[model samples]
Target chain A: MSDAEIAVRDLTIRYGQHVALKGASFEVRPHEIFGIIGPANSGKTSFLKVLNRMDTFTAGMHFEGQVEVGGRDVRAWRNLYALRRQIGVVFPLPVGLPLSVYDNVAFAPRLAGVRAKADLNVIVEGCLRRAALWDEVKDRLNALGSLLSGGQQQRLTIARALSQKPRILLLDEFSIAVDPVTTMRIEAVLSELKAEMTIVLVTNLVQQARRLADRTAFFLMGECVTVAPTEQFFLRDADLDPRARDYVEGRFG
Target chain B: MSAPPPHPDTAALDRRDLAWYVDKLVAVLVFVGGVSAVVFIVGIFAFVTHEGWGFVSEHFSLRGFFGSIRWAPTSTSNPTYGALALIAGTASVTGLAMLVAVPFSLGAAIYIAEFATGRTREVLKVLVEMLAAIPSVVWGFIGLSVMNPLIIDVFNVPIGLCVLNSGLILGLMAAPIMTTIAEDALKAVPDTYREAAEALGATRWQVTRRVVLPAARQGLLAAVLLGVGRGFGETMAVLMASGHAINLPTSPFDSVRALTATIAAELGETAVGSTHYQALFALGIFLFVVTFVINLSADLIVRGIRKT
Candidate 1:
């Protein structure tokens, strides 16, 4: 559809001779939280990497088929950096980037040529606030980002991901290293973020998808088994794929 | 029916076997091998100090030895042991060599660590190691035969062997080890740092300069310091390239004699227990101390990186 922010067609990814994901097709709509749930080795992370062209540096990683974002083929972009700047990604574990907490949030903005200190301070404060980390680290913004606690580092990473004002945000298991309280806090932040940018959330928690995602996709053994609205997806219905139902019901993954 | 469990006393889990004896023996042997390095270093230091102690107490004057430039150890009339000219010669030549080597070695290291990949990186690394393994005498030969006439023709100086020649030779001699250490430093930086920076839309150069370089700065400093230490201790190449005239050089074209070169050139001619011989031993002590301090500080700086 014209409104779709990301459109994938027959996307297959491989590492050397082994296929990581095969024959997948989907579309992510604008201003919506799209959740992808799968067990380990189901290619959720690989799919996220392809969105920002991280595959370029990953040796032996190959992908076939078209992935279009903003009505253009991702592979057709001559300047991959520009393409990546439009998309933000957060990894499973926190990456605090051997820099100060303030610098971590300001990194992307500085790369985009924001030079004035006052402007940087404003952007950093705003992103940190949005990530719900400002109150905790406001006084110690100059401290090393890596020195922060695990939960704080994850939030700092989220703040950094937000600094670019990206059109799409790809998060891979943002709650893995976060405490339950911090996870709930971040989940609230994501709900607010969906009003501004599209989010592709890959999570192991099925109920988390229920709590946040507007629509959800089920990936099983490297295949896209089904995609449905969050409400109907969890319902035990004849139309629902039995494999997805079994996975969501915790029978087997 | 299930088999009967083995009795605890009969099992004898703690009993020593042939492998245990071999392990203990190997451990003792390796411990001695490791301790021998420290032992040898201490022994050498003790010997140098013992030889130089007589000169220090009986004939040594701190001012004449350090301040005066005239190094007339053989003159029966005065026999002054001034080493200022030699010290300045060593300092100046090493300074110039660092000027020549730092940029070259760092550039090569960055290229190998960040840009080159696969077969190219492997081949370049092997070649650098091979260069490091080249004997100092061979490098001395290159300086004597190739660089001598070339420097004379290019600079229009009367003497081909001068600070310029020796510094250039020394620079080339030190570059291989410096490059190797610097590459190791860069390699020590985690790939995650590079990937994170790259994912944030930073260019490759930006990633290297902003992320990787800052992360590896301590190790890089250690690499440069180790190169300086190597320059201070090198003998054959500097002796061959330097003109061996003791002088306070005002320019790179002026001929000079290094401290290491002086010990190497005249150590054979002096009689036993002679003041001139003892003075040379004093110089040896000085060189040993300077090199030791440099290497120790470099090691400490590298350890600082690990602590962080």
Candidate 2:
């Protein structure tokens, strides 16, 4: 079989009177850095939420398609916690828990039923180092999470998500609120993470997708216009849709 | 530039400086008023201590207090001024009240804030506020006339008013305040926190417990403390349903006396300078101190939450 880890087929989601995903379809390959490029208000976040059944439009609304992850219907799964353990999410802004930095990273694993102190310490340390936050927060892991600076806190959030050893990392504009230098560092970290986990980044930044993503999908007005190799989608004339070109070229109505 | 050569317009500068001086004076006056407002709370403690000082220290005979079944203040006999029985009665009633109040209050708060639809939430919110506004006396009368007789008959108890009577009355009264404050606290939690947890595939119950409740822990604590304070200090409801007995209550069906009830019932008949009168004053002092500690603890928790 092919190595695609997740596939969405003709997924249409609506909330009462509003449609969030209109016949959207895509596939994410294993260990790939795939970017979902969209302008603001394009319903990209909603589509991502639908992957984990976190969409608010679940009741009184219908989905007209199937989302299969690892050859299983995403909806039919009983071990949702285990499934979620293999898939983590980082929100746009840093969500600082009212807990200490150590507890923040240790949260998911503990929830995943990792109770032993030695095991938790190992997982926390490994994830923090992987997220490149250990050096900065190594000594003050006992400090409250809100005490960290913005970029550092965002990195801490990623470490917290990664502590569960997820197979796919869903990042919704993880570095959008950070400085340019910090954003570049996060971009580098994403490239490193791409070697082990599938990284699906939902970003409004067209240039960052151009710079890093191997395959990019362009979302416009709640529809995926094109999904192609990043270089061809950006450089080749025929591979680009008019809307995609407009967005990539910085022209929006 | 030497401050731009004094701005070249000394008279204009002087006018601006005078206005600034007047503003500073007003600001200082306001600051002083703020400080004195804090000092005003300190003064309440002083006033209570000044009048009720020795009465608090004057020891009552525990033998006379517990042995004598009669607590009446006759014209000739020495008054058997005992609050031990009254204190025991108060603890039992309030404890039962808390048992009924806490869970229902928290459940109502969770529903109103997290689960209820928008219109339903609004209606429930208004109803809770209206319940909070209902006079304690009105609630007392309702309990005495409507609820007391029903409970006595349902349980087939001898006392028409019992510990359960006071508990049910105060529990109903305290529910609204707990629900309102707890809802506000739960609502204060940012939406993004819930979204993040849900995205992690946590069930709704898990999200509520692990994320929402922990996030609102301080607020929930404050709500419980506030409820305890209210149940402890409530006079009218307790007076009406507590049966006004100055003896140890043996069961939930037994009549009881609380601190507020003892003071209220006995303060009028005792002579002005008698030990009996001062002991009632001492009970008032005791109630005040208990409520003060409760409120102070709530304040400390709230401040700690704010700092975090």
Candidate 3:
């Protein structure tokens, strides 16, 4: 419990009578990339929602069992905002807020009470640089964020997520709207970020897990099918769960 | 593999059927329906200008019409048709109405759009729309009977049928429509923006203020403008509540007359082709132009939002 940055024990998420994820148990170690690969409707997004208590606002979304971030259960935090500040989330599609590009990246920092113009300028530039977007957008940070290309907007979203300086970053299929080259650039950014915070990368691309995750978990049909170190998880004759092996090998989603 | 089936005859496939005729007929009908709106607007404008033209050419002077405050058209030896007082009265009441309506409507819109959920949201929306449906004459009755006494008693004014009374009535009358439009504007902001801001640790208020309100700014501005238009064109309520006196109101406590009220009150009594009658038509023309400008600007602002 002390060693793990995020610990889940028998976590189940239900939307009314429909169970989205069931009895999941896993741990994400501090400063490590933990990938969750699954097909559509496999509950990967729902899992990410529970990590930051986002389920609270979702109608009829009920959660059971324990989800701990930093040795404390998420529900135990009296202030939901405080809990969310520790965990940043990127959605399946890039959502460029209806604001200027500079304002979009500065949003989280402003919320965290970073009021100084100089301080905000620094954070906005630093995050945009790390997200690999500053060079392209520096000339026009005053432009509306939504006016940017899909790929640039995705990088802006990443910059926004990083602005909060979260302890855990959750990305749910962030590459869906981005180009391959930009996706590669973001992958590089995430690899570098692994040293600072825990990351839960939920992706449809299975090979992405092999490339970035220190340990990868395969989710299938609302269940945590397997969680293993990357080397052991992809070994040809490692006696893995057949579903995990088949899914990873492009046999079936 | 096997012998191909005969192709369908191109002439048979291309033949116009009953459905095609019906579709053409419907299109023609819809086009007429759309064009009729523009026709009616032009017709109304033409009629108002035609009726007011005699007075404009014969008796009208720019200084007397807009600058002078003496509106005495039946003074036997010296008939002056100055509308400065009426214009001032209307402007004062509409301005006050906005002051009252903007805050109330925006708060309700924010509540219904952001905080209220499920049955509460639905019920609140329906209630706001129902409030909008309450007749202006009924609101005038309330202003006359209910608000008049309340204002007199609350402020210890000698008379309550003043700018304050009518402004309050007009504000209440305008708020429901404003709230409905403002709620729609707020709802038009995508939910993904909220989710994105929330994920970045922003509280609900912070998200609404920083993201939702800014996104909906143009729509909200249009809503407020529409409310101003509603206040301007309102006749019965302002006629009943505003004391129907031609005065340049300097304070809320001063009784004032509005442009619409003047026409509604004076048009029937005056001779049909007389200078006074045509002058009332002139006021009608003024009201028409101002409201038209407000509505057009609101429409343009809403359209500007869509282009972005």
Best by TM-score: 3
TM-score of 2: 0.83
- Give stretches of model 1 more than 4 Å off: B1-16
- The TM-score each candidate achieves on chain A is 0.98, 0.94, 0.98
Provide the overall lDDT of each model, using Cα atoms, as 2-decimal numbers. Answer: 0.92, 0.81, 0.93
Q: Write the per-residue lDDT of candidate 1 for residues B29-143, one digit (tens) a residue.
A: 9999999999999999999999888888888888988999999999999898999999999998999999999998999999999988778999999999899999988888888
Sorted on TM-score, best first, the list reads 3, 1, 2
What is the alpha-carbon RMSD of candidate 3 to the true structure? 2.0
Q: What's the best-to-worst order under lDDT?
A: 3, 1, 2
Instruction: List the lowest-lDDT window of 10 residues for candidate 2 chain A.
Output: A55-64
lDDT for residue B155 in candidate 1, whole number 0-100: 83
Q: Count the backbone clashes (under 3 Å) in each candidate.
A: 0, 0, 0
- What's the lDDT for residue A21 in model 1? 89
If both were scored by lDDT, which would come out higher, candidate 2 or candidate 3?
3
Backbone collision tally, model 1: 0
- Winner by TM-score between candidate 2 and candidate 1: 1
lDDT, residue B231, model 1: 96
* Candidate 1 TM-score, C-alpha based: 0.96
Model 1 scores a C-alpha lDDT of 0.92
Q: Candidate 2 recovers what fraction of true contacts?
A: 0.33
